[model samples]
Target: MSDDRSPSTPPAAEALTRCDALVLGAGQAGGPLARALTDAGRRVVLVEATHVGGTCVNEGCTPTKTMIASARVAHLARRAGEYGVHAGKVHVDFPAVQARKDEVVAQFRSGNEQGLTEAGVEVVMGRARFTGPHAVQVALPDGTHRAFEAPLVFINTGARPTWPDLPGLQDVDALDSTGLLGLKERPEKLLILGGGPVALEFAQAFARFGSDVTVLERGERLLEREDEDVAAALTEALTADGVTVLCGHQALEARRAEGGLSLRVRGPKGEKTLHGTHLLVAVGRTPNTDDLGLDAAGVEVDDHGHICVNDDLLTGVDGVYALGDVRGGPAYTHAAYDDYRIVRDALLHGTHRSWRDRLVPYTVFTDPELARIGLDEQGAHEQERPARVYTLPMSKVARATETGETRGLIRAVVEASTDRLLGATVLGAGGGELLSVLQVALHGGLTAADLREGIFSHPTWSEALNNLFMQDPVEVPGAQERNDPR
Candidate 1:
């Protein structure tokens, strides 16, 4: 007997390619889930509107981090004298840096495409929208149309940078996070709007690249989601690097100016006009649900435009699910990857997994990376959960002093009665890498004592965890201490 099955091909125009499952948006979730379903002997059709590897590979993580790495190297080279290395004057090659970032993005995207192709998943390039509850219509990239029907449909269309509706802002040329990554020439002066992680990361990276960067945040402080001390530390760090931070300021208008653009901003003091060679709006991201035809599929979205889903990531309609930024919980690539696992287990393994109460870890790739897992000091207080908070300055860490990177601090929040680790924030050098140590401990249900008493390597950043957990709970100046009910 001869086998009749051949490799999957793109759907013909005006044709319908029926499959057991249809995965939309080749993001962190969709791509992985497609491969998983295929490996489990299920027919899967994965459709991507733009590029493969979704936002993380094409724009968010892969490309941004590659540029961030270049900026870090440039920064370190400039500081080589502190390390007793006579490194000559360092100059940033902006074009080369952009080229390297492009190379990395291409390599990642190619790998994702190859993986899906080899997995026997039918890959289609198109903008997909639901024609009905179980049927989807695609406008293919080649100006062709195709339809698909599947019992199980997953939407992972990810998010895009949000442009604020400031007056005259749209008329003037500005760079979003995506646009910033593609710049071949470094701006002489960069004015950033937004104090969030994305905004701060770009601010620092451009500053390190020798741009006179200024961050104009409407919020009262940077990283407002974090504790006040964390915000202060980050502000100080950015300031030390010569980045002017203007918090509690709003951009009222924008216009073309000599040599660049000018923004009129309103601050506590008064109104001021700021000029810059470039403007970056890193305010936030909105989900890609508007064009997905959710109404036809009976899928619900919240006021913020994120698809409404249950704890298991299922949409309102049966057999239809949403994951990643589209579903809108944590907008991290790892969160989306975890969402895939939850869906896979529920669909194939007969095991139910929920996103409820799951611990998500995130890192900001600044000079001294800011990494956090679980609740921070403010979260504990806001929830009114009785917790003990221990704060340790990086100055106390031997490795930090030896490396001349004693600029940040480490804070751990633990359950007062059970001694369980609740959360931690690491803001020193290698903070992101070091947060994993506590993440593993948290996953294993280890107490703060476990981390404090564990034998850590000598003169290393991980060893700082020992001192962080062992120290007495320092009294936060304006924070009230609550008694544990237990």
Candidate 2:
């Protein structure tokens, strides 16, 4: 990270290119912001070190989900007998899957590049360093330096995978999320080093693709942020998919093995040796802010290296703003785009929309997806907000029962006093898609009774809501469902 360096001195004046705005990285937020700034008749310069699209198209969402789709086909083929289809034995073509993923990624990246070209955004392919509050110098590919000076500078370099601090881990050639996406050979036995969404999603996908996958989570449970029941349901689904999920386990050390890789782990029982063809460390990611010499611009970053920003996404420095994963909270592609919108309106329309209190919904791309929005049961308890929890097994949903994909649950929390919907978690097939219904209801201020009494088309997941909200509410402590709406 640039934070480790001394303050940057200004670049040569003759080589500088002045622009109305400078975007540091062509990530989710920075790419769109660059074009938008150009549309506003402002000369925009977009500096990208590698690909046109950031983690999303190049590594994270696009490539991974494409392979997940391939894995889903293998999973379905194995279960074809249940659907009365006589499909042959399922086998994954690892190279073919990689090719498809690469093709999709290339198309997305080219689209972004084409758009930037049409919009006349001057793109300097280089690593960016802040020389001052309004000045940035780029170390170009051909050993030349290019500098940009703008009144407004946006940082959107996003984040990358962080390695865990286990002894010998770095020496072992373990894969990060990006590296895993590009692996040439499928692991015969895969070991995952985290319990978060990245670990869980990839665990299920590779397991379905025929890898003997083991997940070692340091916490007592996977998705420690989610409610116990919700996390348990997801863990069960992954286990049923043939993934060995070991919670409360920490990697003591890692080393290169005879055939692949070896990890020594400790659990409640005792220390054990786990062997795998590959290891993926999906613990988390840190911002790219550290290497940009933010201190030179007087831009503050949190202890974790995330750039500090206010409700308006404005940094401490007046002309500088940080967007997307670099700004820290809610590191999702959609959230990053919304950051663009916030700053877009503020600068172009003079309307400073806030970053606080935004509804961030996310889905884990597993067989039976885990989608969540707003507060969960534990959150209500922590906030000491009165709430009523209602849970329905997927077995109870007609669609789930009919499809024979009844492996998860849908849980909702409603404000006990007013019976208004607060949050919902969907953990079933197409759960991510189903979550939009709950999101819409919450966004529209719909109540439990409203959904319970509402009519939905027959045998659809949406129709399950009629019975979901009709269930007897589990009254949480200090919370009771009331007949009064107000």
Which candidate's TM-score is highest? 2
Deviation from truth (RMSD, Å), model 1: 5.5
Candidate 1 residue-wise lDDT, 1-486, digit = tens: 853532122344367778999999899999999999999999999999999999999989998889989998888898899999978999999999999989999999999999999999999998988888888988877777788999999999999999889987876789999888878899999999999889888899999999999999998888889899988998999998889999999999999999989999999999999999899999899999988878888999999999999988998899999999998888999999999999999988899878977899999988788999998899887787778899899999999999999989998888877788888899989898889988898889899888889999998999988898879884322223445343
> lDDT per model, in order?
0.89, 0.90
Q: Model 1: residues >4 Å from true position, as ranges?
A: 1-13, 475-486
Per-residue lDDT of model 2, residues 327-395, tens digit only: 899899999999999999998999977888889999998878999999888888877678898889999
- What TM-score does structure 1 among the candidates reach? 0.95
lDDT of 2: 0.90
TM-score of 2: 0.96
Clashing pairs in 2: 1-290, 1-291, 2-290, 2-291
